[model samples]
Target: MKGLTLDAALARLLIVVLMALTLLPFLSMFSAALAPSGSYPPGLAWPADPQWANFAKAFEVAKMDELLLSSLLIVVGTVPLSVLFATMAGYGLAKFDKGRGRWFYLVFVLGLTLPFEAVITPLYYEIKALGLLNTRFAIILPLIGLYMPFGVYWMRTHFVNTPKELSEAAQIDGASEWKQFWLVHVPLARPAIMSLAILQFLWTWNQFLLPVVLVQDPLQRTMAGALGAFQGQWGTDIPLLCAGALLILAPTIAIFLIFQRQFVAALLQGAVKG
Candidate 1:
């Protein structure tokens, strides 16, 4: 590792800087969240005195519990609905190559290209027509739809890579097509599924724009929405606001810790697997 040429050493230095660039914000936020009360943090130089109570105070001050519950419900509800259909659609597209021109399927894939803003206007009217505005379902349902293209594409890619022999062998036995997918195909899909779950969970959890438009009712406001409001209400309450920011950051950090293996394996999987 130490035998690098000058150019290689410079490249390593650059890479380390870039890595620190990404990590600095999170590190600073964490330090601020734990900094001692009634004083300015040492501006991320290092923690002066760690105050664990900020987390509790943040929850109380921001009324983050309701917002947390709202955000959680959106993620929990949407991930499953979108993943289920996306799995079905992707699997179907991969295996059933007959019935329709692939152009139609490509349209499903192409949807990933369209910017969400281009579609939001139409979506607004559509939500109003359904009388779903100002509701959590309104926010969550649109998010599920918006995220579908990527999920389906990911699962489809995974299914396409799977050897057809597995399905063929399953069909040779008394196993039905559904059974083959569940017992055989799904097992192999773990990495792809995990990746999708991670991306979708984070995306949905931090989602702000859709919720802002579709859900004007504060009672239904999500964590992101509440965070926005909290920013307005307590702009100078650094400790309190940082506390809320950490509140938003906690679940994602926990999730990543829990699934770090999946993330690392997925990285290695991409490097090795097709």
Candidate 2:
């Protein structure tokens, strides 16, 4: 009993330490952002007079309003289409794994092995050829394609673990394939879908490389991608740069905090079932 109690205490301590380690950088950045512009903040030291207005200044300088709109456009273009296709493809693969579906599943599995960096060169050329090199479609289209493998994989995991009896029962009721997917499975797969959407939203929001490579306009790029330009212009102003970075990061943090429960629940379900 004492040994078990000691193990539990140690686990709690470890968790606390990990949390501190994870939070320390953000704390330092937050402190730095509150320091007066152009001054390098001493490591993690609280400023005597915190310049709270730096956030406002950064917002103005970064043109965060436009960036937010552009990011929204890209995310809106990418997430729904990707999720829909992935869910349908996943359902097909999971339901009909006996034949050519296995081949298609293998293709998507192969896609999972591909790294984003490896395809960037070819992708850039392909986008250029399509005359989408400097457009939002450059990011959106590529992201949809890139996300397919993992998205399909994630949805497939959920579909595969679902009771076949539910599908069979729906079939017995004279439901078409479309109705079976829409009415029967989709409603039950809400948690997985929501979790996938959240993950994709975060990924899309933070996308830097594709936006930077494909789009020249800072306003057209994602907030995180445009940080390159923001940093280049404000490199000498440490506090302002940190402030801008924090602003760029704020939405992602806010979203995760709000939907963390759903995310955790989906993850726990996957862990238990998979």
Candidate 3:
């Protein structure tokens, strides 16, 4: 009991330290964002007069309305389709015969090793050939393909670990393969799917490299992707830059907060099973 008590106390202390470490930068950024537009606030020092207008200024200067809409469109286009394809592919890989599925699974696993930087040059040429450069499709199509390996891998792990008995029972009840997948497997895979959606949403929203390279218009790029131009224009304006940075980060933070329970549950579910 004494040892456990000591361990608990140590853990609590470590948590507090970690929390402070994590929050310190955000506190500093918030302070910087509130400082006078031209002035640099040192460390976490609070500005005498908080420049709340900086956020509005940042929004206007960065053209956040356009950026936000573009980001939303890209995410809507990319995440759902990626999830649907990944789920189907994962299920196929998990349930199908080892003879054919293993080779296909290995192909996707190979995809996991192919980093964006490795094929980005050819990808640019390919998009140019398709006349997709400078359009939303350029970013959307590449992202869906880029995200496939991990998405399929994540869903496969969940489906593979799910008990075969459930499928057998469903089959005995006269459920077709399609019915079994949609009715029995999908419901059980909800947590995993939700977690995968969250991750893909974040990745699609924050995607910078592909958007920057593929799309010419800043308005068509992801919010974070547009930040490069925003930064280039307002780089010297520390407060506005900080505000823009915060705005770029806000959606992802909100998403994680809203779905934190589902996310944590999915991750823990996998960990526990493993």
The per-model lDDT (C-alpha) reads 0.81, 0.93, 0.91
lDDT against true structure, model 3: 0.91
Query: Ranking under TM-score, best-scoring first?
Result: 2, 3, 1
lDDT of 3 by residue, 1-274 (tens): 3656887989988999999999899889999999999887787899999999999999998989999999999999999999999999999899973998989998998999998899789999999999999999999999999999988888888899989999999999999999999999999998889988988898899898998999889999999999998988999999999999999999999998998998788678667753
Residue-level lDDT tens digits of model 1 in 55-117: 898788778777878888888889988888889888988887566836657888789898888
Candidate number achieving the greatest TM-score relative to the actual structure: 2
Which segments of candidate 3 are over 4 A away from where they belong? Answer: 1-4
Looking at model 1, the pairs that clash are: none
RMSD of 2: 1.6
Between candidates 1 and 3, name the one with more favorable TM-score.
Answer: 3
TM-score of candidate 3 relative to the true fold? 0.94
The model with the greater TM-score, 2 or 3, is 2
**TM-score attained by model 2:** 0.97
Q: What's the residue-level lDDT of 168 in candidate 3?
A: 97
Model 2 residue 131 CA deviation in Å: 0.5
- Judge candidate 1 at residue 247 and give its lDDT: 85
lDDT ranking from best to worst? 2, 3, 1
